[model samples]
Target chain A: MTLFDYIADRWDRLALQSWLHVSEVVQSTLLAAVLGVLIGVAVYRSPVGSAVATGLASTILTIPSFALLGLLIPVFGLGPTPAVVALVLYALLPITRNTIVGLAGVDPAVTDAAKGIGMGRLAVLTRVELRLAWPAILAGMRVATQMLMGIAVIAAYAKGPGLGGEVFSGLTRAGSANATNQALAGTLGVVVLALLLEGVYFFIARFTVSRGIRG
Target chain B: MSDVDVTGLSSEPGLKRADRVRLLAQPLAVLVVVGAVLVWAFARETDEIEAESIQAGVLLTKTWEHLLITVVVTAIVVGVAVPLGAMLTRRWAKPVAPVFLGIANIGQAAPALGVLVLFFLWTGWEGLWAAALPIAFYSLLPVLRNTIVGIQSVDPSLVDAARGIGMSPRSVLLRVEMPLALPMVLAGIRTSLVLAVGTATLAFFVNGGGLGELVDTGYKLNRPAVLVVGAVLAVGLALVVDWLGALAEQLLGPKGLG
Candidate 1:
């Protein structure tokens, strides 16, 4: 049978796998964004806190994905819990860094004026600083989404829900007839998902960034 | 001046001793712990598998294989990407740069494993080149982009001055542009080096020998100790490479620039 034929045969299963991948990515991305932004906010006031936060996030990148999953396996067992945890950890650096950057880029003069007008610190942050920094924060989210998309494939190593299982099994069984097709579908799903997420991010940027800034 | 500016200005460039200790000590502690674990695993494993001389050499073989892929991939990526990036920045070739970059973006967008798997399936074989080729493809983007950005960001006045001093266009590019671009280009290479180190472990999946074999065996045999050791070594190697890269970047950059 042709590759498409095999794909057609496996459509339901593939769709379910694709859904799992997307859901996990969404769950992990949201969690990372919330946690990252909070951490960024907490640390943005102090240079030491900022440096430590950034340093810690970046250090997470040094761990190999394969080994990370393997290490987690003993503790978390074979499932999405460990997979999501790893994804969140990997996603933290970009989002946190971006949040810090965005918040930092807010003009001190603007905040001063807001303060002069009797706006409280919390009010200034919510109404002005974060508003101004929204674009950069969103950019970070976009990057995190893209990265997590690629990483979600590795999540399948821990049997986390995703299209990676198909890819992994097909890869190991490359000598078989339909193995390439299976792998192709899985890989194609991943790439397509990445592109689609990127498109969503573009649309988001267009609508969300202040019109003056866009100009 | 505002209170914030006053406070910020009060801190000297020289880090406090406490800050220095915190900066160096934390990562060093992690390294020490990781090292202790690996040594323990190696010693224990030796006692368990003493009969197999080849088995004993797993550490040596894996490290060697890991280095081979890292070196070959880094060489190929640097060789191709640096020149291609330079070529793209030329006046006539500027328009085509994005097209090439877009292609690179797609390569990066795809999972590294997916790229490797494709290459392996296409070649119907697995070994050094089979793995290295795809990794090079995946890693080419950062260096290429950095080189272009670096060249373009070179001070126009400096180029004009070179011309003013009777340097040929070729000389201007060779002497002025490249030297100035060195830091950014090196930064890009550093990024790729870290990437190559992490990705090289995946080489085991494609039948390319590396420390990943130890990882895989450890996983399959339920030996968490070996798995942890294999992983720590790979990660440790990445950190070491990153440090070395930073050193190179600092030293290789134009003297006054740093």
Candidate 2:
């Protein structure tokens, strides 16, 4: 069958799968951003704590996606649970590291001035330091998002959702009719999705970062 | 002759002898821990397999094969990225550099597995080079960008001084620019090497034969021991490779800038 024919035949299912893929990426990245930021904030205040946090995340980053997914299968017993877990763990390094750098990078004088204005710790953090650090944090999330887009493909090995399953299925069916098409479609889907996300990030960055600091 | 203050030029933070030893021991510690795990695991799994000899061979051969793929690919990436990167940074090539960088960015942006599988399918020739070539392509970005950045960031006055002494452009680049860029170039290589180690595992998909086969098969067969051992070994190898890069950085990074 021609590639177009295959897509036509599989369009509905492909659409569902594509949606699943995007949702999975969104859920995973959001969760990772939250947790990674918390970890960064918790540790960034102390040099030793930041070091340990960075070290732990870096160690986790070294583990191959294939192996990490494989290792998780038995523990999490496959499907989205293990896939999301591994993605979260993998995503942590960039986000956490970026968070620590971003927050700590806020000018001390700026923060002190904010504090001197009677802004409580929470107000200053939420309104001042975090605002200055938002761009860096977003940049980290971007890296994590892109990294996981590739990695989530491996999640298919654990029976997780995403275009990866389609690709893996095509790979396993390699000499079969239209298998290459299937694989190509899946691979293209992932790359396009990743680029689109980047586009979205650019849009967000334009609006989210204040004009003063956009430079 | 570079007069770059090679002393104190080194950016690696100074370390006491004891601290250096402790840092260096990290991989050794990983080795010990992994060895113990292997013993316990193999001891437990001996009952499942027919012969101890086969398991040992499988482990060693897979590891060697994986290392071979990684090294060959990373070397190829360095060979290509450095020279190509240098050329793009040349005066005549300024306008075209962004195009090359964009291509490199796509190579990096594409999922590595997709790149590998796509190449495998296109070539339809399974084995080392087929897999190695695509991975090398994927990993070329870091070295290329670092080489460009390193060269561009070199002190212009030094290049000027060399040229003032009647040195050829090539001589000036080799003597002044390249040396200044060495640290960043090496750093790029280090990143590529670490990435290559991780990406090599997917070579199994193309039937190029590597540690991934062990992990993949172990998973399919529900042999957790084989899976764990394979995963641990890959992680260990990655850590070892990363440490080696760090060591190279420490020893070879601009010297005497201390």
Candidate 3:
């Protein structure tokens, strides 16, 4: 069968896989963003704290996804639990580092102005600092999403939902007539989804970024 | 400040206190963790299945395979990307640099496992080359992008100064541009090395045996000890490799720049 014919036949299954893939990645990215922003806020004021946070995050990033999954499987067992945990851990580094960088990059003068205007410290932070740092935080989410899209495939080996199942099935079913098509579908599906999300990020930046601070 | 910088390449001029602490701590941590894991695994009473895969010789071979794949992939990435990046940054090649980078960026977006599996099926080749080639492709972007950025970031006045001093274009490139770019290039290579080591774990899927084989063996046979050992060792190896990359970045760059 032609590649197109194969995809057409499996369109329903493929579509479901694609949705699951995007859903998990988006969920993980959002979770990481919330936690990361908190960590960034807590640590951005102190140089030592910032260094430690980024250092720890980067070290986590250095661990292989497969290994991390392997380690998690023993504790979490084989399912989406292990998958999500692994994804969250992997997603943490980028989001956390970016959050710290973004918050630190915020001008103290702006915070001072907010204070002069009778804003409380929390108000200054939530209204002024995080607002200004939003772009950087969003960019971090974008990167984390792109990364998790690929990684979610590996997570599929642990029985996580996604197109990676197709790839694994293809590997196991090598030499079958449809194996190539299955793997190609999974691989290409990821690339396409990644590109689509890239566009979504562009639109997000356009709409969400304040005009005054937009660059 | 591009996608490459997402890896958090250190652009600081000199080793700071934190860098020093991390440099000393990373390898030491890896050693302690790996050593403790090995001792624990060995000290455990293993059944036949666990014993089969968790033997000393077997672990060593798997680790060697993993290291070999990492080394081979790193070699290819450096050899291909550095020269190509340098070429792309030249005056005549400037227009097409973005094209190359664009292609690589898309390549990066693809899953590493997909790349490895796809390459395996495409060529009908198995083992080391199958694993290394696609991984090299996957990890190439960091170094390639860094090299171009590194060379392009060189101040034009420095080049002009070199030329005015009667230095040949070749010497100017070899001496001034390359030395200035070395730190960036090395930082890129460090990122690439970490990436290569991490991805090499997937090499087992293509029958290119690595620590991942141990992971597979443990998972398939339901041996938690074997599985944890495999996972920890892989993590330990990556940390050590990254530490070495950090060391190289510290030591290998032109001394005057630091």
Best by DockQ: 3
The predicted structure with the larger DockQ, 1 or 2, is 1
lDDT score, candidate 1: 0.78
Q: Could you tell me how far off, in angstroms, the CA of residue B121 lies in candidate 1 after the best superposition?
A: 0.9
Pick by lDDT: 2 or 3, better one: 3
List the candidate 2 regions with Cα displacement exceeding 4 Å.
A1-5, B1-29, B50-54, B256-258
Q: Write the per-residue lDDT of candidate 2 for residues A1-215, one digit (tens) a residue.
A: 88788989999988888888888988998999999999988887886676667666766776778878878877888799999999899888778877877887788999899989899999998899888888888888888888888888888888999898888888888777877888878888888899999899889888998677987
- Docking tier of model 2: it is acceptable
For residues B76-167, write the lDDT of model 2, one tens digit per residue: 99899999999999999999999999999888877788788777766687889878999899888988998999999988898899999999
Candidate 2 displacement at residue B23 in angstroms: 4.7
For model 3, residues B10-45, the per-residue Cα lDDT tens digits are: 664221444666788788889899999999999989
Q: What is the lDDT of residue B194 in candidate 1?
A: 77
Q: Residue B234 error for model 1, in Å? A: 1.3
Whole-model lDDT values for every prediction: 0.78, 0.80, 0.89
Give the candidate order by descending lDDT.
Answer: 3, 2, 1
Between prediction 1 and prediction 3, the one with superior DockQ is: 3
lDDT of 1 by residue, B1-258 (tens): 011110010112321322233346445856796679756765663535322322447777888898899999999999999999989988999789999999988888888888888788767878888889999998888889889989999999998999999999789888999999998898789888878887898898888988777777777777667777777777767666666665676578899774
Chain B TM-score in each of the candidates: 0.85, 0.88, 0.95
Q: In DockQ, how does model 2 score against the reference complex?
A: 0.32
- Residues A1-215, candidate 3: write the lDDT tens digits: 98899999999999999999999999999999999999989988888887777777878889999999999998899878998898888788778877777787788898999999999989998989998888888888998888899999999999999999999999999999999999999999999999999899999999998788987
Give the runs in model 1 whose Cα sits over 4 Å from its true position. Answer: A210-214, B1-27, B42-56
